[model samples]
Structures are given as structure tokens and as C-alpha cells.
Target: MADIKAVLPGDVMDTGAAARDGAVLRLGPGLVQADERTSAAAAGVLHSDGDLWWVAGNRRRYVAAEGEPVVGVVVARHGEGYRVDIGSAHDALLPLLAFEGATKRNKPSLAIGTVVYGRVVVANSFMDPEIECYNSHTGKSEGYGELAGGFMFKCTLGLARRLIGSTAPVLAALGSELPFEIAIGVNGRVWVHAEGPEKTVLAANAIRNSEYLDAKQCRQMVKELLAR
Candidate 1:
């Protein structure tokens, strides 16, 4: 089982898991390194995944972090890039050449309010963040690009994280019932597409309601939804 404990601001964290020789520790949101020690920067539950540690709090506003996949809406076309609203304090810049194989002569023309899935390439507190529609290492699209013809909705950041996990019972339950395509962004946005609008709405609502449900409860909820 994973170690999960509630913590308050300024609480020192046990660094044993991150203290393995030659292992580098990665700190996530609400955690900070002060005086060469790790401590909580916000009141939340402490969670550790391998050498990465973070504090999960009830925060609706997003703080951009590099390499996190996000779903954003194009709000305006700026010079050489588009300003995207990624549920952050500031809009992120998506350069025209950020897409796979894009160049000066050939680039995507995105309209305002268009939805896109991209990864954070640069996130600095001093400047606005930047995003890209392709994998920098592999130079592949990797399913990062415009998200077209889907129903988008917002949920809590915690719920978004849960839906993105590999073992999300709600997703598993929904998958067993019908075919659907989903795009989840850590920024608390979810896009769902199914064979029909009704099915899409059903799947999205199931996901929203399953945030606090157990595995068995998820399955039962899906069954009840299908019966109605």
C-alpha cells in the first residue's frame, strides 16, 4: 500500500524513500526544499510515487509544471504563437512551429475556442508557460494535438488525477459498458466522445460521480446507468 498522510504547511517530510544513494528526488506541487530538507508548502495529503513526492490539496487553480499533459483552449492568436488558457493564472504560449512537422510555410491555423491537447514544454514563475503538440524526445504526435468533436467538461483537480491513473475504476467500468474515447488533462478538463451524444453525456457524468466511489460502487453505478 502507498503511504498517504495528512500534513500541514511547514511540516517536515520523511525523506527515507527519496534518500536512496544516487537517486534524485522530484518534488511536486505543495512541496518545497528548504534548508536542504523537504517540507510541505501547503496543507494537504502527502503522496509518494517512487522518488517523486507531492502534496494533494483541494486546489482548483492550476500551476503549470513542465512535462505535464494539459487540455487547453485557444483564446487568441499572438505573433508566432497562440495564447492558450490552460486553467492557469496566465495563458500558455503554443508556438506555431510547436506541432510535429510544422514549419514557416506549413503550420496549423487554429481558431479561437478550439480545444487542444499538449504538453508543457516550459513552466517558469517569472514568465508565461509554453506548450507543444509533439513529443520533444520522440518527435512524434503521440496523440497530442487538436481535440475535435468531443464534449468537454471540468472537474476537481483530484478527480482529474484519479481519472488519469491506470487503475481508475470509473473508467474501467465505463469501458466495460460501451466504446468511448477520452482525453484527460491534469488541468481538470476531460473530453469524452462516444457513439452518440447520450452515451457521451452518460460516460462523462459517470466519471464525475465516481470520484469518491469505491471500485464496487463504480461498477454498480455503471450498471444502474445502463439500466436507465
Candidate 2:
């Protein structure tokens, strides 16, 4: 039986058979089939919802998935799009026309090494993933596009998720000490901007260090960092 716990690769979540209770099980990300076993493909905490099972890992790498938002860096310009490194197995495409209100004659210009936040439009194992900077339905930017000045850095996907959580205690604690703006990507990138560079660096370091900390530990960490 699969119980709530931290799991590693090759740790079996279940067998490829129906549960004894007659409930069907579904596999989510970070899980793969091996023979008749469903095992973890990454290291992290295991989570389940109803019959669904998935793993959340904290390695500094990105896994591309459709509809997921990610932070990307422009690597090169292709014919009609830009090649973006989203810390994935494959580089993603951010087309020149993928922005809000973009047109042939009104394309946005981005230099190499530009940081961007976008949603994955296409992510298939057979091809490179594609990203878009606009909401297709509303045709608005909606906070997706070339990210402005900030101290951008990378962290583990698990840490990124924790930082992005609405009630993350680390963020709350840091907010008490510094005024900052942050953007978190599920793909393991973070951008932080504060009134001063020192505060931004402090906030970033605090977040990265708080990955393994509990709520109380996180508050203590913030206090220690601010005192330095």
C-alpha cells in the first residue's frame, strides 16, 4: 500500500493492478511504469489526490509539461521565434508572435539572455516544448512576458513551489523584514526585486536556505539573515 511519505527513485508507489478496494489509480508527474510496478522517477515528497499520485522533487531542474508556467532565458533567435532554456531536457520555443497583441509588423524584441515568464503551450516528448507570453483566451499579457530588472536565480522545483505557495511562512517572514517583489516558476527559477540590491540578495538567499525549514525554523532563519 502507498502511504504518505518521502520517496526516492525506484520506490514503488503501487503495483500496476487495481486497488483492493476497487478504486482505479492514476499516475501523475514524477512517476513512471517499470514492468508491473509504478515507481517514483524523482526524489521528493509524495502526494495524492483521490486516485491520483505524483511526486514533488527538489532538484534544480525543470520538467516541461503542458499548461505549466516556467521561467526561461533567451538563448538564441530562430527564424520566427526564440530558443529558450527553461532548464528542461529540451529548449522551448517562444515565438516572436506569441506575445499579447503581437503582429508581423509589431513583434517584440528580446536580446539573448533575457529572462521571461510564460506558460507552456506545447510540451510533448516527441518535440520541443513551446511557450507563449499571453493568455490565448483574453489576448492579454496578464503578467507574462520579458521580466524586468531583478535578481534572477535558480533553485529546486520543490523550493520554488514552496515559495510560491500563498501561505508560505518563509515568504511571510522575509516580507516582514524587506519590501520585495518576487516571481516564481514551477520550473525552478526565481526573480526577486527590492528597493536595494542588498535586500534582494538577502531575500533570495533566505528563500533558498529555507527549503528544508519548518514554519518556525523559517522565521528564525529570516531573523538571522536580517541580522547579518
Candidate 3:
């Protein structure tokens, strides 16, 4: 046997992440690129257009080694469930039970733009990776949710990283204290939850402009309590 464990890339049509503009790359026969940068936790291989490039998909930001934790983004809210867009085409679902004291009715109260830092309960689900915010021993919000506030003023990915969990406080152009919560997914999807819609918009602007942010940036995000 030719070492069946060593799989090769399929045809271009067989690959799903072969996108243009650096979105994807075709490695070669039976091997396509699957990530642009490291820290993606997992990697993928495919054969698309006879080229190979790393495309980020459903890859965990941190490796899931039984007790390791990873962060993810929320893509959808299904009444009592949520679909997280953690670099995967198919968003993983966090059910009502995922939340503390959650019920069929109160389950729908959670916002969709929440980021969750959870322990990977079931890593290799058939279609997508599954997770549980609360462990079997206890129940909690899984160290995820509206952790901070502010909007992304800049559109670039670099600026987004600087703003996520940045201690920079947001003061409006008009001198109003901008109170907001910003959830930045590893995939560069920034979600903002502000006390006032206008404040949120300003924070987002500051986030976008993080590249040019001054020294007196918002250093204090909201009071945060999470596991290290």
C-alpha cells in the first residue's frame, strides 16, 4: 500500500477553500493551502486549481488537548441556540444549556455578537467542532460573551487586533464617555455592544483607527472576570 494514511489533495473542484486574492492558495496535486498565519491550532490540505494555500476554516485559535481552551465568534442566534463562526464554514452551535440557568424561554435572550472562550468538549464533530461553555462539573458563561466595548474604526485586520481587549478607553469626538462592549473573533469579525448606540459607533471608529491611536487610548475596558 502507498501509505493510505498519507492522503493527497483532490481536484480543484473537490476543494472548497480555493479563493482568489490571497484568500486561498493551491499547493499542488491533492494538497491545498489552509491557513495564512500560524496559531490557527489546526491546518487543512486540499487540491484546488493545481495550487496550494492555507485557508483558515473552523480551525481552533488554540489547540484543543482535552483541557485546553479556545476562543470563537458567534455567527447566528437560533432562539435558544447560537452558531459560532470560528473560522469554519459551518458555525458551531451553543445550545441553551450552554448558558447558566438557561431555559427554553430565557435562552433566546442572548445576543448573537458574543465571543466565547470555552473548553472544547467535542472537537471533531462530523460537520463542525462542538463545544460546551460550562463543564459538567459546573455551569457558567464559558468565559465568553460581551467582554468589552467599542467599534472598529479601521477596516484592516491589524487595527482590529490592537483594539480587541485593548485597555484603551473610548471618548467621543464630542467628549462623551463611550461605554461599549467589543467582541473580536479571531477571524477578524468585531462585534460591538455599547451603552448607547452612538457611543458604540464611536468606539468602533476608535477601533478602526487604532493604528493611529494616541497614547491616551481607552486603557480600561469594562470590569472583566474570566479564567486565565
Candidate 4:
């Protein structure tokens, strides 16, 4: 007979029952599938059904359902929808409305290759977990090409998670008293709008490393460069 499942607050389990499938049975009630296996307790990584839903009393609670965070890479585009590559599952769906700063809805918005990271907002809502890209919230690029003065710079994907607002001065070498606008995008891109290319290159280089610059340092560098 298959054992029922359970969930507890702590990561460790002291008195979990075992199943014939070899996986540990959780502390509460859950009938295993006719032909399935589970661990005694969730000692290793858990492959959730969608997300863990706990039930019953606090001490003897049950993880009746299994689930995980919904993170995915955008792969293809459809009419007002996106096909994302969610590991181990089919590509998830992303709607145009899901994108922030989008004036229009029910049409194409995000481009392919734009990796969106987010947890499954609706795990059981669909057959698979639903993902809401963190990129969507950053007012992601609605425009496909360059802006007025110049195009944005590209960097490592990790930079997207550590977005520095436009107010923060990054690349110090660009110039001080620039008298121009510089916008840093959270999607690992930089937008510079100055009088000429010389100023643009200088600013781009300094700002590229802006993540390490302090306000005072940025000011000093901008001042020194502008005076040049």
C-alpha cells in the first residue's frame, strides 16, 4: 500500500514513513500514485506537483500537493502570448498584459531570447506552473532597436537582478556636468544620450563599472572628465 504525504516547517524529518518506491513518506496524509516512488523525508531537492500546499494541524501537517517556483526562459512569441522554456515542463505562457509599461494589450510585446525570471504565481491554476517574469516589472524595453542618441549596452544576465536605478551614477569615466541624460536599464543594458560620441564612449566605460562606484566617486570622476 502507498503511504500518504505530509509537510513540516523544518527542513529535517525525524519520523517519516518509507514507501516501497524507496522515497520517504511525509508525516501526513497523501495517497501515492499507483506506480510512483518517493523519499522518506524531503532530504534532497523536491520535485513538486506545482507548489507545496500544507493542510491539517501545525505539528502533523501534510504536504498534500507538491510544487516549485516557476522560472523560465522566453523562447517563442505568439499573438499576445509567449512560449517559454520551463525546465522539465512545456514552455509556459506569458501574456502581453503580463508585461509592465505596455500601453497596448492582446498583442505581441516581449521579444524572443529575453529570459524572464519569476515564481509560479498560479501553480495549480493550469496543468503546469504559471510564471511571471521579473523582467516584466522593470518596464522592459518596449522598443526593439536603438533610442534617439545611441543604443543600450549589453552585459551578463546576472546584472539584471542587481538593477541600479537611473539615479545611481555608475561608469565614472564618462564625464561630469554632462548636461545630458543617462539611463541604466535593469535588463543589463545602458542608454546614453550626450552631445557626441566621445562623451558617449567615456560615459559608457565608466558606467559599465558603476555597480562598484560610490556617489562621491562618481561625482569626482564626472567632474574630472567634463573638465578635460
TM-score of each: 0.92, 0.79, 0.42, 0.35
Error of 4 at 78 (Å): 2.7
CA lDDT, candidate 3, residue 90? 54
By TM-score, the better pick of 1 and 4 is 1
State model 2's lDDT: 0.82
lDDT string, candidate 1, 1-228, tens digits: 258899999999988755765568877778888788999988999987766677889887988877778999999997889999999999999999999999899999999999999999888779999999999789899989999997999999888877776657999999999999998988999988998898999999999999889999999999898888
Scanning candidate 4 in windows of ten residues, the lowest lDDT window is 53-62
lDDT of 2 by residue, 1-228 (tens): 245589998888754344766876666568876676788988888876557677886555677766677888999997899999999988999999999999999999999999998989887678899999988879998888988888888887777765665536889898887788887887889888888888889989988888888889989998988898
- Steric clash count of candidate 1: 0
For model 3, state the Cα shift of residue 170 in Å: 7.4
lDDT for every model? 0.89, 0.82, 0.44, 0.43
User: Could you tell which candidate, 1 or 3, scores higher by lDDT?
Assistant: 1
Off by over 4 Å in 1: none
Give residue 147's error in model 2 in angstroms.
Answer: 1.2
> RMSD to the native, candidate 3?
13.4
- Candidate 1 whole-model C-alpha lDDT, 0 to 1: 0.89
Checking candidate 2 for backbone clashes, the offending pairs are: none
Please report the TM-score between candidate 1 and the true structure.
0.92
Q: In lDDT terms, which candidate is top?
A: 1
Error of 1 at 76 (Å): 0.5
